[model samples]
Every structure is written in C-alpha cells, then in structure tokens.
Target: MAKNTGASKFRKVNVDEYDEENFQDNEDADVGVVGPNENEVSNFLNQSKNVEALKAVLQNPPQGCKDKRLKDKVVQVVVRVLSAFKTSDIEKGVNALDSQSLDTLMKYIYRGFEFPSEGSSATLLSWHEKVYAKGGSGCIIRVLTDRKTL
Candidate 1:
C-alpha cells in the first residue's frame, strides 16, 4: 500500500437524511390570470378603430389566460379586425407598427393559424408575409421562444 496524504476533506452522505417533509410543496401558489378588458375592446370596435385595437390586443394580451373560450373570443376579435383592413391599407397599417408590435402581430398570426375560419387563411397569410418581410426570421424565433401565449 502507498503512503496516504489527506489534502482534501469529503464525507459520504446518508440517503435517508432526505425525507418527504424536507421539501416544500408549491402547488398552492397564487396565480394571476390577467385577461383583456372587455369594455375597452368593445369601445374600440364600436368606434371602428380596428388598427388601434389590434395594436392594443397584441401589446397587452391576456397573460396567464386559462380559459380557452376567452382566448377564442380574443382571437376572433383579432381575426375580425385583420379581416376588416382593406387590401390597399394592409401595407400602410403594418408599416406604421413599431418593432414590438410587429413581433406581437406575428405571434397572433401563428395563433390564428391554429384556429382557422372561412377566408381567414388568406388574410393570415397576407399578414404573415408582411410581418415576415418587416421582422424577418427573428420575429418568428422570438414568438417561439416566448413563454406567454395569446
């Protein structure tokens, strides 16, 4: 046997030291489900401010929204607003949005694709093309990486 020199200190730990009570359960944590303001959205729609409403919806979606029906309602509103835009105005309206708004729009566009309605595919495709041109692939990447869903 070779001569032993203790230059470091270490000890084997007992697995029994870890018990169920040692871990704290976090299942009851408080959750915030912030949805869009209905009155505000209705007001925008009633005023025919589709562009503004679109920007508002994209900028501030219902974070942590759990209700599928609620999300569908919001998506319907967005799709309706998108459909309302005249073909001639699509480019102009899209160009007016800031980068953040553009990315959010891209996110909604993909979400919209999940629930396709009659004639919505073409409109969403138009929007996707325009947003991709302005935001490039980075916008898609951001949308994919983002944890928040609209």
Candidate 2:
C-alpha cells in the first residue's frame, strides 16, 4: 500500500483535508500597501518602474503546462507595451520604451502572435500608426509619435 500525501492518489486537489476555518480571511494587498479587498490600480499611479513589481509576480507564478520561457517573454512584452500606453506624458512614455517597448512591439507583431483580446496591446498598433501618420505626403513629413502614448 502507498502512503497518502494529503492529495488524492490521482493528483486531484482533495478538499477533505483543507481547513475551512484557515481559508477565511480578508487582507487585501495592493501596490505595496494593504487595503480593503478592491481593485489593485494604485500601482498605475506611481511614476516608478513597474517592471520590478511585474517581475515579482512572475517569479512565483502558478505552474502551467506551457513552456515558461515563451509565456514569460510574451507576458513581458505585453506588459512593456501596456506600460508605455498607460503613461500620460510623452516623456514618461519615451522612458518606458527605453526599457524595451519598440523592440517588443515589432517582435510581437513579426512573430505572428495573436493580438491580445483585451487591454492596450490591442489598441497600441493602431494608435502608433495614427500618432505617426505616414500619409506619403513626401518632402520631409514629420510624424509626432510619442514614446508610449502612440
């Protein structure tokens, strides 16, 4: 006979051993602070680099069956692009790009990755084309493409 390791023999999550009492708690964590259980948007307001925060999230993310490196790169690229889009100022957007936005954008597009179903990545490509319109106006046509705003 094999020893039982709390989990079901078939690797399913058996709820029988789970402590119902221990699972009930309400401590909301958000953007380096504790608050009520609500949307965690506080980080968006900060002017600091959000990459560190995102890296922390991926460091111990849920174990999935897919290749982690590919998934991580995809997620990272999306985050960089989205981060650029979120910043309101052109300078800030430009700063975000330095970390890796333009390269990521072209890479994602060239790789034939599917467009994100939600959020900024879905909108950024069009937004960029709009900001820096290449209307074939010729004779030194200037495009006002911003770092992240586009």
Candidate 2 is scored at a TM of: 0.28
Which regions of candidate 1 fall more than 4 Å away from where they truly are? 1-33
Q: In candidate 1, which residue pairs clash?
A: none
lDDT (Cα, tens digit) per residue for candidate 2, span 22-111 = 574333323232111112222532445444333332233212224456544545444443444443543334333322333333333333
Task: Give the range of the ten consecutive residues with the poorest summed lDDT in model 1.
Answer: 25-34
Q: Put down candidate 1 lDDT per residue, 26-103, tens digits, no spaces.
A: 342344644456577667877977777666666556546666888778777778778877777678778879998887
lDDT of 2 at 108: 33
> Which regions of candidate 2 deviate over 4 angstroms?
1-48, 51-69, 76-84, 95-101, 109-113, 119-122, 130-150
Report the Cα lDDT for candidate 2. 0.37
Best by lDDT: 1
